[model samples]
Target: MNLPPMIAALRHHKAAVTLIALQVALTCAIVCNAIFLIASHAQRLHVSSGIEDDALVWARSSGLRRGDGADARARADLDALRHLPGVTAVAQVNTLPLMGNDWSADLGVTAGDAQPAVNGAALFLGTPSFLGTLGVRLVEGRDFHADEYVDYSPFDDTPAPPTAIVTRQLAAHLWPGQPALGQRVYIGAGSSQGALVVGVVADVARSAISGGTSDHDVLLLPVRTVAGPYALRVDPTHRDEVLRTLPAALIAQDADRIVTDREAFVDTVHRYFHDDRAMVWLLVTVVGSLLLVTALGILGLSSYWVHQRRRHIGVRRALGATRRSILTYFLAENMLVVGLGLAIGTCVAMWLNHWLGERYEVPRLPLSWLGIGALLLWAIGLVAVFGPARRAAAQPPMWVIRQ
Candidate 1:
């Protein structure tokens, strides 16, 4: 298409053109980054905790005081919960996924106060039914034998757990190519307390997301003690019923216990990711609002330009510029304007990502998203100008003579 006339017209309207171009530039830059952030939030929300979250529920209490009576009450409470309708498995647990980061320890291969081979693996001390209730699949080896499960005690003389189950990520981190099963690893970076790797599970998330592979590096020890919050596996359909009524039942069953908090495991996951969900919606709103404003700006400018240049368009039609050519002219003009904005915006987007990365450690927005954003803006600009372009092209030859 011919460019000289369009260039001359743009020069005559330099201030308006510059203003709209700047708007497009900012929109392009923001949209790219906003989309990238939305995607990041989405990924975080969907990251697997590797537990059967849907079938689980946990109830915390002012119960489970440490003593034989407390232990008997805890066991009785477990029995009461298990016999309740729809409960498939039950265990007393210190930590649960999306619950909180209650404890973490490092494990060393050499086993004598040497530097830990794996850092920040969350420790789980649950009953014999812990794996069954948590619903983590064993990828290799076996669950702790019934005899292997021990009562949890702060004063136990055992140096370390006799057996442990590890996540696949943790296994790979410590042993690399070697099998993690049957490998003896130290419990802490400072102690020679040794534990045997009897089982390897696919994944079980740490109590908290640490934004690293350490989030998957969990160590499960078989400690058969009833205390603290209890993890229950039930029919998914029955989870709500269990969550709602179990607390009341448990409270009524014993005078020593009082149910403090009750929640479905899936609901806990949602609550844990509440900030990510909010950010996703916020970015979506910002992107939607900016695109709406940009489209309206293009539409308004094209309509006004058509009105001001009426005589010029009629004269062009009289001089034999075809209707198709007139439409193409307006469309091409908008493309050129938006293309300039996109070029400027690409640089701005990169700079914005760099700035964000430095301050927030946000990942760089990919080049592909930049290209996609440019194409989207190009299409929007063409669509916005189409109606005014058609009106300018539709005037009859006699209309020019009358004017």
Candidate 2:
């Protein structure tokens, strides 16, 4: 339990001790941040799209010959898609969730306000069957009536419709304590008139995932539009057949229009988050490898120390140092080294987190994660040094003196 001798003993091998401490420090810092990133990515990947992803498929068509009545062609395409076997509902939508394209509007409580109350809520334009097609549950209010539907075009300079549907998250954000229905929120930067929140859906994720609570912030407008793409919900048992046949059906409706980007909704989501999934696994692998290397480093250092101090251990054993005392001494020595490394690692982890937050928009490392990382390293250090300590404790004083 004496500190002077152990501190003096460590001083003899300061270079090795310092190197191992630095290695442990580096491992601790990276593992903490890596784990945070992995969790973030995992949460992102698992975010709810708030739709019938399994039964949904979307297709896009471009290269349409101008003056071929593009709007009429879009309507015909929708009709054809709807009539196809296994099709439940189809709609022309401006954007689908997780497709990486977002049409957002600045919303204000009052009309013509200079600053927005909620910024970057996704704007979705679709037909009256939009909710039905996407299978989004209505939590409050009512869906857009067929009479309220408007024909919209991206090229049109008209203002947005006066009636809109909002996600529950956006509704809560816009009106925290009040009923969201009948609440009017203005859109755009200069618009004086606002849209009434006629409906509130359970949830709808934004097109691009964000760090804030705005990930589920969305507003829906009942407008039949061909500016983006078409989404159709079909029988899950026939999803593949529908996907395979729908493109040819649309092409038949208009050969001039080129069919592009046909895939199931779930597949599209998977494709969008493929890189995030890879990063999660990659970070996991790095964390595992780093911890293993740190454990081995601790084991190697403790083993070397045991060999170097064999005679010293024998002398201590002769002077009434019990086996338990020898074991406790090595464990205490490792605790000191690990404690120093953890202290350095905590600071380095924070600094690295600050850099990551600024450069890559990652969240700050939580203090709790640092504590967990420290505890994990401490356990690793103890386990790694146990065997070497046991051997040191079993050294026979008589045998060492004869040698």
Candidate 3:
């Protein structure tokens, strides 16, 4: 049961012991980070887009004009889409959750010469029906009145919107511990006119933008986009029915220029996160492969050690050492080496995480993962050493002495 004799025996084979420890350390660091990334991607996949995913469908370019007629066409199309049998509400907006259309803005509490507090927020330009159409829950304040809606053209002179609605995430960040209602925020740098915040919604997901940010930061302007997708809130059962005949229905309203295929909002979400889904599966594969290789490495090394020490094992058995004692000795030796590697690997894992954070914006590795990695490796080492230890114990002292 004494560790010094076993430790001294290991000292004679420093090169082999060191190689095994270093291999374990490197594997622990890489595997820990890989598993962390897999978990992160899984979380992203399930994040709420905060839209009525099952009840909404959208279409784009159902009659868009570059200049004068764009507004009229949008108007006529909106009226006709509103009259569809299964359609409950319809509105035109610049973008929706997971639409892959990136439009961001910088906004803050003041309008003067100071750096803004909120940045990289998804900027949405929508009409009065946008809130109803998207089905985002308005947690506080009121929706824009019909009179509050204004016309906007990207190619022409478009006035700043008079009112704005913000997500609950952005509202809390900008005005923490206070009411967001009636607070005026400057849209851009040095804008004397402030866009009044009239409402706050529960949450809304955003597409990836230039600077990485939480996808909850979104703002809605009351300016109806002249060129934008028409979002229709329809019955869940009627999603396919609506997508089937929406084109012909738009043609009936004379907005029949460049009408793309109508699609459910949920499909847009799936398409947007295609890369993330792939990365998750890839990371999972890497983790599995590493664990398998590490287990096999331990098994091979233990078997080789038992072969080299056969005569020593036979001498102890001739002196009346039990089979259980021989098995315990090999297992304890393996644990000693693996424990040393785990200590070194903990430091290596943190260093790896810091480098990843600086290079790829990965979050700091959680401390719990170290414990998990150690426990997993410890269990693997025992199981791997058990087979070799049993084979060594089964050899008779007479057979070994004759060899």
Candidate 4:
């Protein structure tokens, strides 16, 4: 329990102690940031698309050739899929969540303003039944009526419809603390022509998952486009059977067009976030490895010190130092080294986090993680040194003195 003697003993082995402390410091810094990265990736992978992922399937088709009537063919294709066994709902959609292809537009509160209110928002152009097909619930206002649905084409010169429904997230961004329903939001920058926000849906994610607040930023327009992707909702129990036969059914309706990229909504999400999942596991592996190496460093140094100071320990035991005292001395010494490392590592962790935040837009690391990391490393140090400390304590004073 005495301080001066332990301090003097540590001073004699300053180089080894400093090396171990530095190892612990690096471990703390890297592990903390790695954990943050892993958590971020996991959050991204688990983000809600706000759709009935298991019950839905999506497929893309090339537009009809010159001889084929694209609109008529598309309608027939949808009708055929709708009649398929176990298919409940179908809608022509421009984009689906986590597809990586996004239709975005800048929103402005005032018409003809050079600056817009929100720079980027996911735009979904579909029929009145689009929300129903995706199973997105309406939190406020009502769905678009059949009369409000407009036939529009992306390849044509027609502008976007004047009526729109928005996600709750977009509504909040456009009009904070106010009812988003019955409000008008300008569509294009510097254009007074805007769409009235007729409805607010619970939540719908964008096509691309950016892992930001904008993930749920969506603007839905009741504009029917025949030449786009199609989403179908099927009975969950019959999803696999429906998925297999649905493609042939669509193609049967339109032999001229190709039904490509058919996939379940859940599968699409998984494929989209594949890299994110991999990154999470990779960072977890790195954290585990770093902690293992740090523990090994502490164990190696403690064992070496015990071996080198066996005679010194025997003399202290002869001078009435109890086994518990010897063990406590070793543990206390390891704690002092670990504490110094933790102090330095905390600063290093913050600095590293700041750099990552600036470069990668990651959020600042929380102080709680620092505390957790420090505690984890402290426990590791104690456990790593315990074996050596026990060996030192069990050394017979007379046997070592005679040797």
Candidate 5:
């Protein structure tokens, strides 16, 4: 029951005690970080994409109907769909934002003295009506007009395309010193189809959730020049009805073309992170298992100590000590071991973070995690020691006298 005597007893079993301590420390460190990472990812996933994610239905249709009349056939199908019941504004785009099928290209801006630099990633491209369909806000420059899509007059004799509208972030990234208006930026090869910066957009969010960055220097062009999937927004209440009738609608206009199937916007975004999220859950499971193992180790060691010290415990019980006193003694010893483990675990957790930061995208261990981890280990120690404490209290004083 004495402190020094109990400490000496632990020293006699140094190897086993160290093993139990190490397990507790490692479990605390690993579990703490795993919980934080999962929380961070969940936070990212919950962020609003700034656009109506629900009340929207999207589908992908590709390949030519015999490759002979693909354009005419696909166009007819799209038009028919636009007229279908519950169908809202329908436009064809290369890719939908947040769906992760973004077409990124470098912009070469031509300033009088500022050389063209391929610096930022633009996360959008679409037809004139693409903006309206996706509900994107145009802050500065005008949207792509029909003439801009078909005209080659300015670029016929020149090397650059005549116009382009970019996001505010893109504007700042390219020309931080001055306005991006009227600035010429080259998009594709030979700088032949030059895009002029006619307007600046507030900022376009490509997905339902963003990772704290709204910086995009998007170059919106006529869909005629690009090749990709198109999105059509549908009312959520009518999603099932739309899905059931979409194929028939397209078939009514162009029976030979494929209408594909309808998909919810939420489903599309979820698919993007399905794999990453699954892996995070798997990591949490593994850490949970390790913590269980550490608890068992502590319990086993505590039980062993009570069994080995039956005579000592009996002597204490016989000397006017209550059952509660004997129970408290073992529990306090376990707490001390857990406290020591946590102290040592702090450095070990930091070492793990150093490796994690270098190899993975996870940030370094924050100070709060360390404190929380220590407290958690203390709780585990109390829980694990409880079993042995109860057993020690159950034994009668005469039991050790007989031994």
Candidate 6:
């Protein structure tokens, strides 16, 4: 029960104790960092797609087969659905944003006196109403006028082409608010095509959760007749009826083609993040497993110590040390070991965070976790040491004399 004796015992087994402490420290550090990283990814995965995804239903009827007459059937199907009940808005596009496949290319801008150099990339191709249908905000300039999207290439020797809308980020990068409406910007490189700056829009958004960047550099053009694979916005309450009627309407128009349906676009976006969103949950499982193993290891170690210290406990009891004193002595030793592990773990965790910050904008650990981690360590130490303390307290005076 004496402090000096207990300290001497710990020092005698310093190598073993240090090894166990290091193992515990490493486990804590890895578990905590994993938890934080998982949380950050989860937050990003749940971020809004910034569109009216809930009401929108998307169906892609691509003319994948070479020289197939399916394009005609698909276009006719789109027309049939347009007249379906509860269908609010329907549009066909060559490519839809966030549906996994995309058509993206590099673009360049030729400001007043600056020679055109390629500096931006955008999702090119869309009609004038694509912006409005997709619910994108116009920050400056104007959305494409119906005629601008339809206008042919100007015959004049002007360096820039007819018209297009650019995102705010692109605008700042190119002109920096020098009235982009009348300014001309050339898209593509080498033989870059000219598209007049008709509007400056707010930042483009990801089509779904897994999209890498905003649709910031989009150049939308209007078409008199769009091709197949249409997206429709329908009232949620009437979705079942719409889905039922959509196929029947298509069949009535063309018996050779089949129309497929899926839930609203929002649900599809949610599915994209399914794995990433579960990261936090996965981390919780891993941390829980590590803690369980650590607890069991401590318990086994404490049981072994109780057996080795039987005579010591009996002698202490014979010398008039109360059962409470014996228990407290063992508990204190366990806590001291846990405290050492926690200190080392905290330093390692800070270094890991520094490494993470170099690559990502992860937030620093709050001071509150320090106190909470300390409490958890203490609890674990106590639980692990409890069996040994109990065994020591049960030792008899006769056992002391015999030993």
Q: What is the C-alpha lDDT of each candidate?
A: 0.84, 0.86, 0.83, 0.85, 0.68, 0.64
| lDDT winner, 3 or 6 | 3
Give the C-alpha miss distance for residue 132 in model 6, angstroms.
3.3
Best by TM-score: 2
Please, what is the TM-score per model? Answer: 0.88, 0.96, 0.90, 0.93, 0.75, 0.68
Candidate 1 per-residue C-alpha lDDT over 1-403 given as tens digits, one digit per residue, 9 for 90 to 100: 8799899998887876887789899999999999989988888888787999899999988766777677677777888899888899999888897776556777888868668888767888888788989898998999988887776543355556678888898899989999999898777766666789998999788888845667788888887674568889999989888988788767766766778888998999989999999999999999999999999999998898777777888888888999999899989988989888999998999999999999999887899999988898888889999999998888885685466
Using lDDT as the measure, the top candidate is 2
Q: Is candidate 2 or candidate 3 better by TM-score?
A: 2
For residue 127, give model 4's deviation from the true position in Å.
2.0
Instruction: Identify the runs in model 1 with alpha carbons over 4 angstroms from their true place.
Output: 66-70, 151-158, 210-214, 252-254, 397-403
Residue range with the least summed lDDT across 10 consecutive positions in model 5:
150-159
| Per-residue accuracy of model 4 over 229-310 as CA lDDT, tens digit each | 8899999898888888977887787676676678888999889999998898899889999999999999999999888888
lDDT of 2 by residue, 31-93 (tens): 999988998889888888889899899988884333558767778888999998999999988
**Total clashes in model 1, counting residue pairs 3 or more apart in sequence or in different chains:** 0
Question: lDDT by residue for model 3 over 21-130, one digit each (tens)?
Answer: 88788888888888888888887888788988999999986357647776777788888888888999999888888888867877778877367778767787787688
- Give the lowest summed-lDDT range of ten residues in model 2: 151-160
Model 5 lDDT, residue 217, Cα? 46
lDDT of 5 by residue, 123-238 (tens): 45554466667666777767777666532222235343356777776777777888988887776434544567787776665533335453344556554333445456677788
**Clashing residue pairs for model 6:** 161-194, 162-196, 163-196
In model 3, the Cα lDDT at residue 354 comes to: 97
